[model samples]
Target: MTDITRKQFIKLTGAAGLALAGGVGAPALADTFLHKMVRKPIPSSGELLPVVGFGTSRVFDVGRSAEERAPLLDTLKILYDAGGSLIDTAPMYGPAEAVVGDLVARLNSRNKSFIATKVLQNGKQAGIDQMNASFHKLKTSHVDLMQVHNLVDWQTQLGTLREMKQDKKIRYLGITHYTDNGTRELVEIMKQEQLDFVQCQYAMNARLAEEELLPLARERGIAILCNRPFGRGALFNKVKGRELPVWAADLGIHSWAQYFLKYLLGHPAVTAVIPGTGRPDHARDNVMAGMSPLPDEAARKMMLDHLHGL
Candidate 1:
């Protein structure tokens, strides 16, 4: 779609060559679309993941009624239908983990979903018990990515997770934190631990990770997942009622959501940005940010300067 050769496109998306040229796990609806999401390699194993993913934090804790779930169903449909994966959820996000499990089961998309959930309890056995509940709730035998949420008893949790990985109960394990103050601890853990991923808060407005976490993640070969890419919606408030910058077309951005998300995707260390949403339209817009022609350094600087102006 961006005039890229098929080989280049494969390279960009980390697609598995011509075998998946048609896209291996792509939803049927995606066959008609030419543009697929760009994928970044996981620094640990070199496996690729689309750079835009869905986050379920307070957004997916919905009622059981079909009326309430109709929109969320459409949201997941739009994501996988656009060749996107990587759904980040945590047991702490109320019903989000269960909701995701239920919705994905209803859609019969368990294999299609990249399930990443967290264990938040403070002790090793408590963490194991919680993770067991997550598996039962998510209805999965092997989780794709499991995390130690907010680093709560992270050392113990990591040890247990390593055992799970050894037992094939989980494929990969990582660490996450939602605040800036936690970076020092996170950095220390990253330095000493063999983690597969690191989830941290980062966005145009929240660049605390850029000072150390991001670079350190790259140095350590740990994949980075950015949360709060919208600065917890403060970014939207900043651009409220303003027209999208015309030059955004140069970077393939069509909406402020894409603009904000593209800024995160442009960072070298980011494997994906999991923006939580229950709306189909919002999910669709978020996925577009992972397509080709992301902003370069100069354009990212320009975009940041514009945000500073606000």
Candidate 2:
């Protein structure tokens, strides 16, 4: 096992006083996240993207303080070096958009990011203005994807996004739904709209998306972006004392993060999962899940069983 030191990891990641001292070359294993998943087409432009992404929610809300953001800065660089680039954020996530913008701008890796953010607006101009703020903060000419935050005021935001999409200011458009109520409503809108993506919650414990939401997304061909894949740290808490199962070796899961991530990733309808991270070690563990052996139908069922047994 690689004992990655705090200082050394930071150095390797180019964050302030630390570096990537060891574990730079992680071993290959089965059941790793990237075993067989391929990019799916956007339908509108036939663009293909990897099935894993990073969420910048509470972790990326470090505001303008460099000290509060130093670790996050390193995490971003680590993500880029590790070949993981999809970053999801929003104006609601405090200073998340700004922090991501500042850090990536410094690294000039903004181009490498699959930038996605949200705007919560009750009015048309408020939506437009907030999105413009997002663009300026993210330091990008156009965001890769933009969603109406939490599907709130979709009546105005959805119409506004469709217009913006036609203007080419954003590459993709959709709405987000985080609550149970929002899920039902958003699913119906997705069935009726010509959207390219949808952001929502999905995790082991919260299997609400599995019932009808994810299935419908699969049938409709709308790319589903999973938010709170870590369930806001609830999954980690649940597995606190549990060691990585021995069978995890057969599946190539060396960490609990991989265990949870692989289960969510095993879903065929899932386009990408965005797990938030503030520490580099946790970030690496999360990215490594993208390289796991994908569970087939039977294996997926087994995974569910294993998770419940936890």
Candidate 3:
């Protein structure tokens, strides 16, 4: 497939028209909308990742039924067909890891994905045991990335992850935290720990990361995975009845979701933004945020001011 430029992709996807609940209304375009996945490099290793990644939190905890698996299968297909790769899940998210593993396998796309799962245990032996179970749930000998969830026993877990990395059981090591309480400690770890990635919450409403954490990550050469870029959908409530600002199209943002996500992608430190959803069209819309140029300093300020004024 030939790679399409940002404008070309927007034009292609935009022409498919819109659906209120999901994304493009055209099902045929779902399979052939465009062939580009915007990529950013892992600061620590120069490894490239798609700027738009999927998160499986509450969305993938489904029972083993054909009706339940059908939409997920389509979602993965749309993601892969659009060139997306990263699929972030954790043992904390109920059966998400297993469900994701099953869906990707059903789609024959296991090799095409960059699976990132987490270890949330506290002790060395327990951490080791949990991670082994994660591997089993993911149905993989090696995962693309393994993270210490919420910095829980990070020292022990990180050490275990390091050994696993050496053993090639995992390809990278990271740490994740979703609240401000952990920011200070996360900053200290980024300064001292040898980490490949850091996952945190950073949305327009939750801009705490902009003050120091984001800059620290950039300075330390750590890839940042931005979670809850939409403020867990709370930001949307502020703009419930408002239409997208006319200038949004200039940045290739056609929907509120894309606008919010594009705002996050504008930050240089953000390697990827993982937004959780179970709908295929919504996933398509999320990935489309990566297809356009990010906001510049002036545009970013305008976006902030506009949202704040509401």
Candidate 4:
């Protein structure tokens, strides 16, 4: 983290203290003492990214209404206030790219954010058109990262992305997939292409990535953006009536969301985990997972074992 980020965190914690004295809540107070936000370097460029980021899929595909956008605005504010910058979206997520652009514009956070959008079309021309549309919807001339969503026509789209990078329209290029079925192909592409990043699903409940995808990313020096960190909410369903283990408090984990996110963050190869949420409180809770004292390999194994028993 930068000195500016430390100052921002201190300032936010001071405000949280005031809120606590005003009887806000213990949870708010707990947030005040979290360690400095954790950041990991993008292996390709060495640019530091906060370990926790928010994703825009179903949650961000809202119409243009203050009523619909109010919570989203709060969510972005919470994310920025906690020093998080990466925001993932895609053209396939109906209206999500627009919603993110509008909200980030409203918050004046485009500069502070590392916005990542995708190309989901087939042919090269179609991919070019789709990426251009993403640039408009994201309200930015140049995107921080542009990815091939679900690897749809990955070869064609990747060629287009490389050209865009050369043209300075995108700073980095990557590919994404959400299931193990794509792991083999994803690995082959990683081996063949000089990608900067890869977004995929990874969580305690979804560990298929650990078998190959993650280690390969490490070896290839590609940053990883973990999606579906909660296994698309399947992990929560499994622990519906369960309580967090006693050791969770040692790692500053107060909620199950943080528990799950910290587990992913514990891994060395994970660059960041983008958990989707429209709720400000959930955003705040998720950002807390990026704080220090993450689980070690031993603790991660314990977490997995505990999850299995539940």
Q: Cα deviation in Å at residue 293, candidate 2?
A: 2.1
Candidate 3 segments exceeding 4 Å error: 1-24, 30-32
Q: What are the runs in model 4 whose C-alpha is more than 4 Å off? A: 1-36
Q: Write the residue-wise lDDT of candidate 1 on 1-310 in tens digits.
A: 1233222333443422112222323334455246878999998889889898999887798889999899899889878876787899999999998899999999899988889999999888899999999999999998999999999988899999999999999989999998888766788899899999999999898898998899999999999999988887677667654666778777877667778899989888889999987866466667778889777789999889987886
Clash count, candidate 2: 19
Q: Over the stretch 1-310, how does candidate 2's per-residue lDDT look in tens digits?
A: 2344433433433421111111224432222223333344565566777666778878787767778878887777666665667889999988889888888898889777889999898999989999999999988889999998887798888898888888988989988977777778888898888788988788888889888988988788888888777665666566654565677767756666677777887888887788877776566666666664666678778878877887
List pairs with backbone clashes in candidate 3. Answer: none
Per-prediction TM-score to the true structure, in the order listed: 0.88, 0.85, 0.91, 0.90
Better lDDT candidate (1, 2) = 1
In model 1, state the lDDT of residue 277.
77
Which whole-number lDDT from 0 to 100 does residue 31 have in model 1? 56
lDDT of 3 at 163: 96
Q: Where's the lowest-lDDT run of ten residues in candidate 3?
A: 13-22
State residue 296's C-alpha deviation in candidate 4, in Å. Answer: 1.1
